[model samples]
Target: MNITRRALLAGTAALPLVASAQTASGVGRRTMNHVKDHITRLVDQHRDGVAPIVSLGDPVLRQPADPFDGQVDDKLLAEFIELMQRTMRAAPGVGLAAPQIGVPVRIAVLEDPATVSDEVAEARHRYPLEFFAAINPDYRPNGHKRRGFYEGCLSMPGYTGVVNRPYSVHATYTDPTGHPHHKTFTGWQARIVQHETDHLRGTVYVDKLEPRSLSTTENYLDNWNDPIPTRAAQALRFHLD
Candidate 1:
């Protein structure tokens, strides 16, 4: 799922200001530096035109997004969606939300082509999702069955945490062209949808994680990628139903 970050208006000037706010919000110096470098890279990559993805601790991410009003052929909305797609691809993430790029609009994009090994795919019950965008999305758990899996976000670069979510979800939303859509997603696709939907409602994966299970990407790859530790669920007090 694409994680949303930052609260400032878009542009170079807004970055430093957001960085300072992140610092004041008690994010460590190391984390702040990491975020700055991250923001710089995003800006450099999208220098052509894409908007930058915000980093965590920006108050904007905590605010609920505005609903898309179905403005078909809206030039600015079209540009925003294009830039978000480009940004998600550059981040190499499976999904992204407008809140991730400093716009608090209820719009998101997600896609996955079963890019991992069969082992990993089976572990997560993964499947392919053709590219799609949702506006003003609303969703709910489809069943009591839940699955826990490692989750990451483009906005929260270099971290992965385990979050348990329902194995299936039902959702309804409008497409950019004002067409409405409703579907039930299972497995990894459900996870992706829930993650993006969380952003629209002003939440992130961290909020649902067993906090101690959260780790940097490097550390997770080095130490935790194998069989999940037995006490992880107990420690996080998470119940896998």
Candidate 2:
């Protein structure tokens, strides 16, 4: 869902999307140059070099991000990844995608210390994930299993909704060093991977969320803070499966 102007002005919107680096023939030099220039201008605006996270209404967030086809040199790409990681941590979010930073590229960084109460952790199947970048990442559901939980976005700020996602997924992505990797992620980590990958495709959690389950952050904390979303599902009259 789109954030209201009031929320955007309040600077409450959440984190950004990711992409891969590989040589490709279709990407024009001119386009890459423009992207480089755009990134430079964005980074220049902040003293700490952290690009401001783009909000929901931004066109960049709605458009599909380009694949990281040598858009910038290795040094610049590294700096951008580091900037994204810093932005995610500053946003205090578990993940961030490139589109959130106004860069329409298939790139994202994710990490979660999973510092929560035991009950919450167990209910959500939450666990710590080491920081890693996913470029041009894609995933496929491993089975029919799915799980629903409260989800929020940095771009959509101030709201949370119940989203059912595949319980596990087999994912493929290229790392910053241009090496390809494949792995299966389960539980909360699978959810994080799918969420970021969807950004590269111009999708957001709201698109897949239970609309009736939507709640302002305050309401969510006050009324529906259960480890599982059973109470919310019952009260909201929404099916979770």
Candidate 3:
């Protein structure tokens, strides 16, 4: 999530794993410095202690996370759920994976208020998301439709690229309470699910994007009306369906 696969593909595959959840790799340092500052500001304003995001290039982000067995007490899972939810909200991102916080467990949390103008809401099919947690989740595309848009990551703070994804998906998982659950998702909801699930599988959005379309947030905003690059489809020789 933090470091795009292309960065590694470009010759930095040797990035090390984070020693601790709070530690970021050399690549993460620059972006995380800003994240830390943002956290500090949040602390100063609201006193929330948010967990730091694990940077890209960490081995954990590249390795499949461990699935949780119901062996642990409900108390612990409840606490972990709260912590992950708080961390996700604190990071202020729509989703957070266990590996992003250096926990190698197959758990993730997601919520989105779609706090934007009508254009964004219409474009993303955004909806107000209530707090939800997924344990050992999995999903499959409907194969009926596909979507692409500028995707960003908390781990990969400053950069964004357009990623094509299924417009709808069906997924299944267990809740922290050991309850089994299954559901279908579409639009932005589906995208969020895919993004977090990818983290659990050691796959990042960067792995699916056009390498030439990658750009810093600032650059992306400056160069394109939307995050999608103008010549990206032609240059990349791919069409969004």
Candidate 4:
């Protein structure tokens, strides 16, 4: 199915002044330090630079990630961000979360060049999004409007299911530079944002997917590769809003 290109499309910066305040308490400090050390060890263990992705059944994927405070110094955070970007690209996914790589921090990177057939692009409302990092990111649905499509994840390889998500969202997050951003995302970009942010909350698409819609990647490619999920929803006897 060339899933990486079809499914996954899925940043860094300096030491900012905010880390000190966010991690000021002794307990918070300790937690951040532990997370930092763990990340360091993971990086060191993967001499090849791309850390192996943790998959389903791994406890790390189910635990809510700690908020990114000054857990690691700016340099280390930059290195980690680069490492994440490398791993995500290697996974051939459009987005990746920290926990996916065994770092349980509220961070994720996402980008989609929107390189799909014109029919798919139009049907999916897919467009190109420049690569960027989202630290401590979150989102709210813009309205009741929703769309469903076959979704896949790097952490849950070889499977896809129909998951309906808000068509638009109001997203907020900090950039790698420590600056905060508030923006609106629509279409496929909104889906990508929600997917990655959900990871920080210890949620996966499967939790919300239509169970009957689950299919192996090969089957998805062979029988349900439509740009939209209408056919899958009907065949699977699931309702889509």
User: Using lDDT as the measure, which candidate wins?
Assistant: 4
Off by over 4 Å in 3: 1-48, 225-239
Candidate 1: list runs displaced more than 4 Å.
2-49, 70-73, 227-241
- For candidate 4, lDDT tens digit of each residue in 2-121? 134444332000123355565675666677777989889877776466888888899988988888877788877887888888877766778889898888899899888777899998
TM-score for each model: 0.76, 0.87, 0.76, 0.89
Lowest summed lDDT across 10 adjacent residues in model 3 is found at: 7-16
**TM-score, cand. 3 vs. native:** 0.76
Model 2 score (lDDT): 0.79
Cα RMSD (angstroms) for every candidate in the order listed: 11.0, 5.4, 10.4, 4.6
Model 3 residue 213 CA deviation in Å: 1.4
lDDT of 2 by residue, 1-241 (tens): 2222233234342121122222244335555676788766666666375667777888888888877777778887887888888788777678888999888888999888777789988988889889999988999999999999888788888887889999999999999999999999998888889888888889988899999999887787778878898999999998796
- Per-residue lDDT tens digits for candidate 3, residues 1-241, read 2222333222210122343642444544433444344333433443345566788888979988766544245765666666667776655678889788776668889888767668767877877768799989999997778878767887776787778889999999888776888899998888899999999999988999766667776665555434234455565555544
TM-score, prediction 1: 0.76
Which numbered prediction scores highest in TM-score against the true structure?
A: 4
> Clash number for model 4?
7
lDDT of each: 0.69, 0.79, 0.69, 0.81
What lDDT is obtained when candidate 4 is compared to the true structure? Answer: 0.81
For candidate 2, give the lDDT of residue 161.
83
After superposing candidate 4, which stretches have Cα over 4 Å from the reference? 1-26
